[model samples]
Target: MANAYVLVINSGSSSLKFAVIDSQSGDAVLSGLGECFGMSNPTMNWKYAGTKYDVSITGGGDHHKLAIKRLVEIINEYGLAEQVTAVGHRIVHGGEKFTKTIRINEEILAEIIKLSDLAPLHNPAGAKGIEAAIEAFPTLPQFAVFDTAFHQTMPSKAFTCTISNELYKEHGIRRYGFHGTSHYFVSREAAKVIDKPIEESSFISVHLGNGASVCAIKDGQSVDTSMGFTPLAGLMMGTRCGDIDPGIIEFLMKKGWTQEQIFSELNKNSGFLGVSGLTSDARGILEAMEEGHKGATLAFQVFTYRVAKYIASYMVTLDSLDAIIFTGGIGENALPIRREILKYLKIFGYKENEAANADARFGARGIITEDGTPVAMVIPTNEEFVIAQQSAALL
Candidate 1:
């Protein structure tokens, strides 16, 4: 049997992150990024067959069309274009309309664009890329895998806001978690690691990265998650001020802050960067903390504290947590952060195996918990591969 290959594309407002993966084995055959679109120095690069290549776009990166054209050209040059069976796109927001991965059609594309109001920074670019891909490979099977789809299983208690019913009904206002793909993938892997059936598994999947979120998964479905309405609500992220009081926004506006200015502050200047008055990168914060920087220390404390608090709070949602699964940039690589967060979970009987916890980083995956204690494991999230697999499955 031939391996099924999927071209996975995650399109941002100004960038495209793409990979070709063998869904059967979950291995990316080729991967790279196309970024700085609409700029003078627009560029695209990829790593394929143990070789890396860089290409400067001939004209300005005015739009997704040019970058995608070059992408298809390269794929054809490599002869993998024909081998590719389908394409999977990562749509950041599907609103309440799309609850699962579905093959894309004209109606689907239209729906994707309509939901842009809910994900201004993501859905529009995703829709544009989908349009380009349709133009590029008109016959290929393409699918839309939404980040919010997996969380649609969340019960009303977990998804509802205390706002009026009219607002939710009329404006589509309510909690819609992001990173659903990550949470879903990690929870399934956590079940495997614990040697338990996914149907019986319960977990608090913590996807800690620049954009972080904690999700409570039970029986392989998302019961609740940290992110709400937008990606801005969640664990203290690199820049997002997660879970703030509504009054703060109005208060700031009355104090002479514009709506745009307040949003910029909350989404770009808060979190570790705002708290530490330093860079948003966790590595930088850790290094600064080691060097005795007070701001860094404070950032580390607040970051870890909030994460631990979230994990603890999520524990009540699950009848029995099979494990506290950690996966994402900061969750997988930042052992110090994981170790610190686990220390806070010690009260819940999560004992980290110092050696294993320290060893599990940079492509490593394993249980970081001590023997016979409540499990806390680190499993790297593979959202792209999940996208590839889900995209293939719909066929």
Candidate 2:
């Protein structure tokens, strides 16, 4: 089983990320990204044996077949292709239908097609990747891990919207939180970090990156999450507006804004970029703030405040806060932001070990809080490992 490798794939609208993991240790044997499909300059950038290489793909089209074909070549070149026993995919939305990871079959793929209405942007891409993987590795078993599966345990009160029950029952309109794989991996790891059994631990897992969400986990199940029906309805993000008044959309439409125009701005131009009139990145925000740019300063404030506020709000959902699991790019590395957010949670009596927080970064993992009651940690998320691990379980 140690030689059984799982090839994990995360398919997007125009790109796919692949990683080969040693299911035994969850260590990546190879990882790479294929991007710009259906374009003239389609390319694949990959890392292997501590070296990076960039090369143009053979074909350019909307289909991922050519891109994945190239990845197969890379795998074979390294002489590890034969050991690859299965494939895993990171599916963004599974809706109310799928509650856990499952091996993909023809029927399962068709059901994923039906649920495309819920994740119109992601599920189709995942399906395409699945189809491509089948074409590339005809004999390999395939597994799909849904980002919303772990949150399936959320109670109706947490997932239901204020809209009429008729709409929810008819249209399936309700909250289905995302980032379940990361939330699951980190929450359990967090329990171990603090030396508590996962089944007895309560946590608020904050996955902060370009797309951010907070999940309240009580005794190993998600009870509530900040992200609602879509990823757009949570804390401020790199490019998304997160939560906003429904009236704003109506107001903008009344002000001669097209639906496309309004949504594009909300989903693309807003967040840190909209507020700061600068790049939507933490490093950029920090740099400009140090340079006395008021816009960046304001953006920083809004980002930290909203995240802290959400963390505080999730406390009400859990029985008792065991530790706040911080993961993702910004969550793990953004020291100042993490520190400021911890300051906001001071009311909970979590002693922020300033020295420890600064030390735990750039793939470093540990409890950032001092030895005490309520703990906060910086556990770098490994969604791929979780994908590979879950896929291995099915074997």
Candidate 3:
């Protein structure tokens, strides 16, 4: 019999990323994306094994169904449909109920839907994908690999709030970290980079991108992370305001703005976009800085300073730092940003190796640190692959 394949689906507010891999070997046989989900002219691109294919929708509304339908058609066309044994979903929030990848049934689906308020931008989309996939493959088992699973190891002291226990228990409010799949996979990669066993390695992973977070991983486990309660608390992101004062919202509300208006501004209008007052794109910030834009320069400085400070704090969490790894978009490719952040934390023995940081082509894994300090490396995160591996193991 042909080896079973697992289809990994990651649904975002605006896109759907899918990967199909051999369940026994965890090797991706196909990877693709569906973009502009709710917009006109939605597009689906797929690469199966080695060949590539594309499809377009002239009028787009709900992309979850269309994307899955297109992906299934591609699989069938390649004669790989029957080989798909399982479907793995990259769910953003599993809350406290699911600590690991679990089989998705009606009960599991209901639980995930219950947590929609916690991940408003992600959970509904993920649920849609899950529902669509289950409908397409009625006989196949489905798995939910939560992004919050890896951080479940964080101790109470680190994840708990100073708020009353009654409020916490009553509202289910706590630090349920995201990007766990990325952090989990990258922490393992960092261990390999340092030639040390995962159980002994201590490191901080900075996942800087459109949505950024820093995770302190010790002994291959998450000790603490920057994101708290929501993705809106962390490093400055493309559009989301991270680590802003709570009073700001209160003040804005008192000035006549509603809760939804304040939320829309903070989660969609702020961050690099608000700070720069130009654009949210990191590359655009760099270009503006080069052109002597004061806002961009100040925004970049603030962004890097907060990142450096968090790295220092996370180092304390680890107690003995072995490496400071960078993953995600800006973390992996923005050499200048990485170098600047390292320079700001020079007091913490963090130094940049200009030559190493300048080598942008090393997308897999490589060091960017001076001698004697904890290793600083860029390990490109493959969260979908991690979900696929976890799902394969469960089956």
lDDT of 3 by residue, 321-355 (tens): 88888999999988778989989888878778888
RMSD of each: 1.0, 1.2, 1.9
Q: Candidate 1, clashing residue pairs?
A: 38-61
Overall lDDT per candidate, in order of appearance = 0.92, 0.91, 0.87
Residue 266 lDDT in candidate 2: 90
Clashing pairs in 2: 38-61
Clashes of each: 1, 1, 0
Clashing pairs in 3: none
Error of 3 at 349 (Å): 1.8
Which residues of candidate 3, in runs, are more than 4 Å off? 1-4, 22-27, 49-52, 58-62, 360-362
Highest lDDT, which number? Answer: 1
Ranking by TM-score: 1, 2, 3
Candidate 1 on 192-264: residue-level lDDT in tens?
A: 8889999999999999999999999988899999999999997899988898889999999999999999999
